[model samples]
Every structure is written in C-alpha cells, then in structure tokens.
Target: MSRIADIAAALAGYDPKALSVDGVQAFLAELVAPAILRERERVPLFEALGRVLAEDVVSPFNVPPHDNSAMDGFAFDGAVLDTPSSGFVSLRVAGTAFAGTARHGALTRGDALKIMTGAVMPAGFDTVVPQEFCTVDGDTVRFPANALRPGDNRRFAGEDLRQGLPALLQGERLTPAGLGLLASLGQAEAPVLRRLRVAYFSTGDEILSLGEPPREGAVYDSNRYTVFGLLTRLGCQVVDLGMVRDDPAALADALTDAAERADAIITSGGVSVGEADHTRAVMKQLGDMAFWRVAMRPGRPMAVGLIPRSSAGDAHEGAAVLFGLPGNPVAVMVTFLAFVRPALLRLMGCNAANAAPPPMLRARSVAPIRKKPGRTEYQRGRVTCLPGALPEVRIAGNQGSGVLSSMVEGNGLVVLHHAQGSVAPGDEVDVMMFDGVV
Candidate 1:
C-alpha cells in the first residue's frame, strides 16, 4: 500500500497547502483504484437501465439473418433493366411475399415478386422498386429503367451486426438505445456489474434535518438531500447516513460505519478550519488523509483519503476512498461535479471516455465578468441560443457559495478558468451544461 505522504511527494511541485484544481485531479487519478468486482449480476433486459456491462456483449447471430426487402415493392432480377431497349421496363407478377413468410424458387428475368417490407428475398433476386415508383397492372408491374441501380432497396444479412463480434463493450453503460439493441439481438436479459455502493451524509451542528424546528443561527440541512439526488441520478446504490453533529467521536463513528459498507464515502461540511471542524483529525486518525485548500472558487477546501474496511481502522490501498466536501450548498455540488464524479466513474470501472467530465461548450458572454488570475471560478448561468447566431450566456443568480438558489435557476456553469482575466461581453467562454445531469 502506498502511503499518502509517498503519493504527495511523487507529484512535481506538490503542495498540500495550496493545490491547483488540476493538481487535485491528478492526485485523485493516482489515489482511486477500481473497486473490487464480484460475480456478474444477470438482470432482465427490461430492468437493466444505466447498468454497466460486466463483459463484452457478443452477437449470437447475424441481424436480419438473411437478405430481405427494405420496403413494399416488387423484387426482380436487375439484369433485365439493362437489356430492355424501351425507356421503361416491365415484368410479369408471379406471386406475393409477405413479412414473416418465405418464398422458394427464383424469379425469372421477366418475372417479379410482389414483396412487402422485411420479407425474405427469394432466390436469384437482387433489386426492389418501391410500389409507388411502379405502375401495376393486373399481372404486370412497370417502372422507369433508371429508377434505381442493381442491389437497390435490398438489405443484406449481418448489415446491422455480424455474428461473433462484440456489439457492446465491457464497462459500457446501458441506456435506452442499448437496451433496444439487446432486444433486437433477441436477448431477454443482460449481464451487468453490481451497482456501486456510495455512502453520504452532512456534518455540522448548525445543520438541521427535516422536520426539526428551526433555531437561531441554524439552517435546515439541504446538502444531504442534494447529495442524495445526485448519487441516485448517477445510478449508484446510495447509503444515506443522515446528518451528524460537530462532535469528533460521532463523526468518526459515522464515517467508519459507512466505509465498511460502501465503496466510497462523501460528506459535506466540517472540512474547513472552523472551530467545530474535526473531520480532518478523525480522517487522519482512521485513514491516510490529505486536507487540501484547492485553488478554486466556492469549493477551495476538501479532504481526500482512503479508509480500510477492517476493524483495525488502518487505511490501505484498494479500500474505500473518502471525499470530505465543504459545507456551502453550492460548493458541495461544485466539488462533486468537478472532482468526485470522475473519481466515482473510475471506481465504477468505466472506460476513459465515459469516466471523463462532461464536455465544456463555447458560448459568447452576454456581459463582462470580473475575475482575477490564480483560481478557477464556476458561475451559474443561463444560455440563450438564437437561430443563425452563436449561443450567448449570462449569469443566473447570486454567486454566493452558501446560497443554493444559484444552482437551481441556471442550466449550466460558466467556467472561468485559472489564469483567465476579466471576460468581455463578446469574448468566447466555456460552459459546462447541466441539461440532463443536474
């Protein structure tokens, strides 16, 4: 097991006192290892939404399985089209082929089969002319000679997916379309990894749970609820530890209990240098902890560590990682999106692409923003896109860290990166959208 000091010492220009946002990310990349996997969980197709596949999903057989008609049309040999001297080519109607039915024998050069969409093509037929394009008589069908080329409107076997090839990869998350693809392959169920178990709670005496009477200098605990929603939306199996007071012993007990049962632990509050903050002390006692003052707005203070599941209370490699977030409403979410989310995805065994942060999009600023160099800032914003114009963005609400309303009205975060100065109205800025994620 690599000690926390060793990991910090390995990074170039490492500074735990004042870490950059990118520096924090790089450290976490080395800190979090993939969770130990158990046997693959076999789940019915209908019930496997957002689950990661335990192994490659291979196709059992070719999709379509055979050549078929792409539409309601007449199937015939395309060779006759070239031999005809007339401007239009005609063929005698032989028989009808409906979907789910098969026909035998070949269609002679001058003969055509009236075939519906998805009907298996009979022997010796390679083209199909849509019914609307052809003029049909009682026993003959006619169409322009150049209406389509040879092999037109005919779907070849294995076109969608071939047999013995991987249709979906391991660690790939299943969405609605993925489930449909499985159904198309005639799979009744899918094999997926077990759900990731995440434990979360809010810490601080000033924080109150729901139904508790409000008192002076105390506020209702909103962080826990927001944390709950975020974890569940990510399809994690969430363990809500509720709100713990400022006492050191209670905090330690809650964290120890959570670590034993969950793959990761998240807590909001008691990470700063406030008098009541004992999270750092307890974390260092139970695990190898690094309390960092990150160079980022709203979420500058955080604690990262690894906690052992055994009763010995000593943290080692490959155990549960802890993320102690700031108490501010907005900070908790910001740190989660910027840091914790990516780490969790990695622990979930997701591939690089899926585990990366949501892409940042370019947007023209609607107004100037005052920002200094040396730290990153995330401002809540609403984007307006007009036809034939680049999308424009403006600040949404109060940018206070403790005020959570800012995150609610906005659809994205206007990312003013480190080393960037004041933004002008027309300057292009980056925005991390919250369309489906928030």
Candidate 2:
C-alpha cells in the first residue's frame, strides 16, 4: 500500500464526528516525518538567530582555558587558615594577579596574591577571600579564619565546556545565549538547514485583499496575513498566494502551483460543508485527503493530506503537505496554533522531540464557563495575576468563532478539555499563552 493508504488505515478507527484532540495530535505525529536537508551552509553568528543547527558543535578548547578567580579578592593557600590560633589569618601580599596577565609563580605559606575577578589563579592557591571580607593594609591582608572554605570563589578550567566536548547537539535551535556560547568557542559561522518554503492562500468568494475597495458583503482577508506572520516567525521562506476565489479551477491551479514550488501549502477557508467551497473537491483531485470533524470548538472542520506534484505525480517529484484551516478568523489562528505550527516545524528539519505542543498553565476562572462535555473549547481569555494569588482568567466578552476582536483583546486561550463540562467561577482551567511558541 502507499504511504497515504497506510496513514488512512491507521486512522480508520478515528470517529470524525467526535474525535479527541489527543487523537488528532497522535495521528499527525505518526503521519508526518522530518524533512532533513542534505545541503548545509554556514551563516555568521549574528545571522544565526532562530536557526536550527545542522551539525554537532564540538568545543576546540576549554571555556576558561585556565583556573581563574571568580571574584575580586585575595588568592591564598587554604592550608594556612586550617588551624588559625586566634580566629584570623594574616598573609603578606606577594604580588598582584590581574586579568589577561600571564600565570604567576607558586605562593609560599602565609602569603597571598591580590587577584581581580577573572584573573588566572596563581600556581598554588585554591581559595579566594572576597575583598568585602578582607582587611588590606599596605602589602598584607587579613581574613576571618572561617570566612572562606578550601575552594571558594575559584573557577576551575573547563568547568563550563571541556575541550572536544559537544557544545551543542544537532537540531538544536539557536537562542541569544546559544549564539553567545558559540562566540565564546570562536565560531564565526554556523551550519544550519536551509529554510523551508511555505506557500499559503485564503479561499472564499467573499474575501477581499488589501487595497481593494470594501463592499457590503465582502470581508477583508486576515487569515493570509496572520499565517504569514506565524510562518515568518518560524523562519520559513514564505510564498504568499494571495486570495483565490471559491472556484474549482482557481483552487486547483493554485494548489498545483504551490505544490510545485513549496514544501507545504496552507489554505484557510473551504474545508467545511459549505456550498460555495471548492477546496475539498480540488484537494481530492490533487491527492489523497482526509476531511475531519475534530471534537473541538471553533475549529471542528479541518483537512489534512499530501498534494502530489503536478508533472510526474510520483514520489520523486515530492508532495507538499496541506493544512486546510477553518474560515473564521479566530478559528484560523486556533487551529493553526494547535496543529499546523508543529507540522511546519517538523518540515523545517526540527527534531521531532522538540515539536511538542506549547505548554499550558493552570489558572483560576474569574467567571463561570459554559461548555459541553464532548468537544474541547478554546476560549480567548484575559489572564492576570494578583499578589500572592494564582493566575486568574476570564473569557473575553464574545465567544463566537468569527469574533476576531475577542482574540485581539485576550492574551491566551482557556483550554476546556474534551471530557470537561461547565466550570464554576473559581474553577481552574488550562491556559496556553501566546508569548512564545514551544
């Protein structure tokens, strides 16, 4: 059987009318595979932000390269203070150790070296008394016997990153800290997978593009822009297909064109049981597709499958995965965040383990929530924290699927689970924040 057939067979038991959120996620995880890039190019460290590492980065040398002082203090032999007779130990300063200077000779007993922070430790000193605890007079320093232990405020060589160790594993995404770490290792360039190319469009006869004159019945297309922003943040090379009318020919042409040029194609609108929608029909002609009624509010109608290349229609020509999102603006964002985002990450060569759903935080509801026990609800909410209290959340005024303003007014989604029913005012709910993607 074909790969599509195998996926279909695996999902044969899924009840389209009442599918669980977990069930949809599990099916997607198994159906999609990482698209690893064979070609890798080096990008400058400054340009490597948000890029995934294509190769393991091994350290060429220890981070510090030498033992050093972690603070501005006096470095001395801890043995001299092991048995101080009067609860204090005094040591004559032999010399000063400054950062960037060469290593100094060993210190004799009852002697110390005035060392600055990050200065290489002298040959025989294993302890440092911070300046705050030391009394310095001319060439001598005094410290309380118990103020410092045998190895206080000293940084050993290779403590952070040892030589020849893997500093970063393959498939790791580079953060600000990661870039700094790479810079410390003297890496000017990073090996990263090429960005994935994603093409997206909106399907609706009543949808209007920007700069077009507004009409009474037509609505401005917002899904395309939202999808664009999301894909751009993920670092994908995005291809905007603009707005396609609800005609079979127009959709088929757009799908074929997008499939030929991009790694994935995303369309918002026309996966539902609407007479004006031709997306479902065109999708079936292009490839094997599954139209699902997921058990989730505002995003029940979804389409997932692969669109074969136009020319050879063979595996070699490659297939572009399709994610047909709901038409409602708020629903578009919710469904994309829940399903399409992770799939796009996997297609970009990110590690499967790192493509899990965004984490949810527990928050107390400030108002009662009316919900059914079957379908999961993603209600837009305003979450706030009080002093010494748990985070409190309340749903934005309108819960309509088409209420885009509600999404704009809220910071997160109150995720009512599939088995959960109505919730009282003080009940706890799981909320997914929009600050960052997992």
Candidate 3:
C-alpha cells in the first residue's frame, strides 16, 4: 500500500463532522514523521539562526574560566571581619588589580586589593566592597561594620556554563540569544537540519495575476503571496509555481512537478465541493488523496495526502506530502496558521512539543460574539489592556471569510472552541496574539 493510504488506514476511526482541532493536528504529526527524520548539515555559527540543531552542543571549557570580581571594588579576606570591635573597620590598600592583568599576590590579613570589574579576584579573598561604599584615606580604605559578608559580588568559574556539559540540546531552534550562547562557547559552526523546500500555487479560473485588468467576475490572486510570506518566515525554501488555471492536464502536471522537487506541496482553492475544481480530481488520479470537511469556521474544507511521481513508462517512483487549503483569502491564512505552519516546522526537524499551537491568553470580551457549538471559530480581534483589569478584546468588523482586511487591522485572534456557545459581553475568551509583548 502507498504511504498516504497507510496513514489514512491508521486514522480510519477519524470522524470529520465531529473532528476537534487537536485531532487533525495529531493525524498530521503522524503523517509527516517520515519526511521530518532526515539527515543533518553543518553550517557556520553566523548562518545558524532559525535552524534546528541536529546534535547536542557541549561546552569544552568554563564560561568565565576563572574566579573574578563582579564589580570595581576592594577584595579582602572576610576572616578579619568575623569579629568587629567597633561600628567600622579599616584595611590598608596593598595594590591594584585590573582586568586582563596578571593576578596580584594573595591578600594578607588586614590588607585589600583595589579590584576592577571582571578582574581576577586575588586568592584568599572572599568578598568585595563597592568603591562608593568605602572612604579612601591616603593608602587605606574604611568600610562600615557589617557592610558585606563572605562570597559577595564575586563570580566563580563555570557559573554560567560548566565544561563538558551540554550547552544546547539537539532539536533546539537557534534564536538570537541561542546564537550568542554558542558564540560564548567558541563554536564556529553548528550542525543543523537541512531546510525543507515547499512548492505552492493558486488554482482557479476567476483568479487574476498582477498586471491583469479587473474584469466582471475576476479577483486578483492574494493567497499565493500570503502563503509565500508565511513560508518564508518559517525558514522554508519556497518554490512559487504562480497561478494555474482550472484544467485537468495543467493541474496534473503541476502536482507531478512539485512532487518530484519539493518536500511538500500547498495549494489554495480547487479542493472544495465546487464544479470547477479540477485540482481534486488530478490529486486523486496522481496518488492517494482524501478531501476532508473539517469542522472549523472560515476554513472547513481541507485536503491531505501524498502525490506520487509518475515514471516516464507509467511507473511511480516517489511522492511528496500535500496540503490543500480553502479558497477564501482569510480562510487560507487561518488554516495555514492552525495546521500548515506547525506541519512545516516539524518537517524542518523542530521538536514536536515546540511545534504545537501558540499559547493562548485569557481576555474579556468587549462585545458579544455570535457562535454555534459544533465548529471552532477564529475571529480577528483588537486586544487592548485595561487600566486595572485583564486585556479586553473586540472583534474586527466583518467576520466573513472573504474579508482579508480584518486580519490586517487586528492584532490578535479570538479563539472560540468547539462546544462553546455564543459569547456574552464581559465574558472571558481565549486570545492568541500575533506579536507578544515581552
């Protein structure tokens, strides 16, 4: 049996009418396991940003490498401060220690070294008194009694990272901070997973490309550009196939070409129950494809399967995974976020746990929302922080699938889950922000 058929067989118990958002996600996780577990490539540290690590990176040496002073102050033995005869104590300044200079000799009783920040602390010293806290008199420094105890304002060797310990684990996506950590460890290069290539196109006769004049029943294609931006941000190598007309032969050719070249294929439109949908027919003819009526608003019809490469002599060689999204501009964006984004991350070798849905925050509803219980809904909303209460969210005007401007105007999505009824004013709802305030 084909790979797609095997996956479908494994999910034989899945019911589309009663499908939960999580159920679709779980099935996708299993479907793309084979493509995600591939080989790794070694890339330079500077070029490793947004790439997933293929192996654990262990530190070869301590971060600081030596005990040092954390501030510009006097370092003295704390033993002398154990017994205070008065409300103050005085110590003679023996010498000065600057950063990158050789260590001054060990401190003697009643003697202190004037130390600069990051300078190696003299042996037999356990504390530092900030320069401003001590009153300097000629060659001596006086401190208030009980100003500091042992081990204050001192940084020990390996405090940040110890030698022979894992600095970053495999499957970790390298962020800007993560890059700095690797640089601190003197790593010149990192082993990262190979980038996943995705091929995408738009399918419809009514869709017009740029430079085409507006006609009576035609609209410019926006789904391809939106998908391109989303895929590029996720670090995938995107192959733009432009727009394909609703022709059986053209659809078959595009799918075959994409299957041979890309790791996955994403297409918007021509998969729903529409008369002009030649894409669905070509998909079934080329390989094992299943059209699903997902129980979700904005985006309900989705297709998942594998398209095999046909040999010149009519034999099948290999295949690529397929993700067919809805035609509406807003639906395309919503479904891609809810499903395709995480799937692509997994295909790029990210950890499964990290590829799950973005965290949701609770916010009060400023306006009532009309909703039913059977399907999950995502409404574009503007969320604002109240003076002394939780954030309040109100839906952007026009919740229709074709209204793409609402998504652009809103900063977050108000999520209504399955089995949830109509929302009342002042009710707390779940929100997923587009850009989180850190």
lDDT (0 to 1) per candidate: 0.87, 0.85, 0.85
Q: Where is the poorest 10-residue window by lDDT in model 1?
A: 310-319
TM-score of each: 0.92, 0.94, 0.91
Error of 3 at 239 (Å): 0.7
User: What would the TM-score be for candidate 1 when compared with the true structure?
Assistant: 0.92
What tens digits encode model 3's per-residue C-alpha lDDT throughout 197-246? 89999999999999999999999999989999888878888999999999
Give the clash count for model 2: 0
For model 2, residues 383-421, the per-residue Cα lDDT tens digits are: 998889889999986989998889888999999999999
Error of 1 at 276 (Å): 1.4
Question: Model 3, poorest ten-residue lDDT window?
Answer: 309-318
List pairs with backbone clashes in candidate 1: none
lDDT of 3 at 112: 88
Give stretches of model 3 more than 4 Å off.
Answer: 1-13, 78-81, 145-149, 310-317, 386-389, 436-438
Backbone clash pairs for candidate 3 read none
Better of 1 and 3 by TM-score: 1
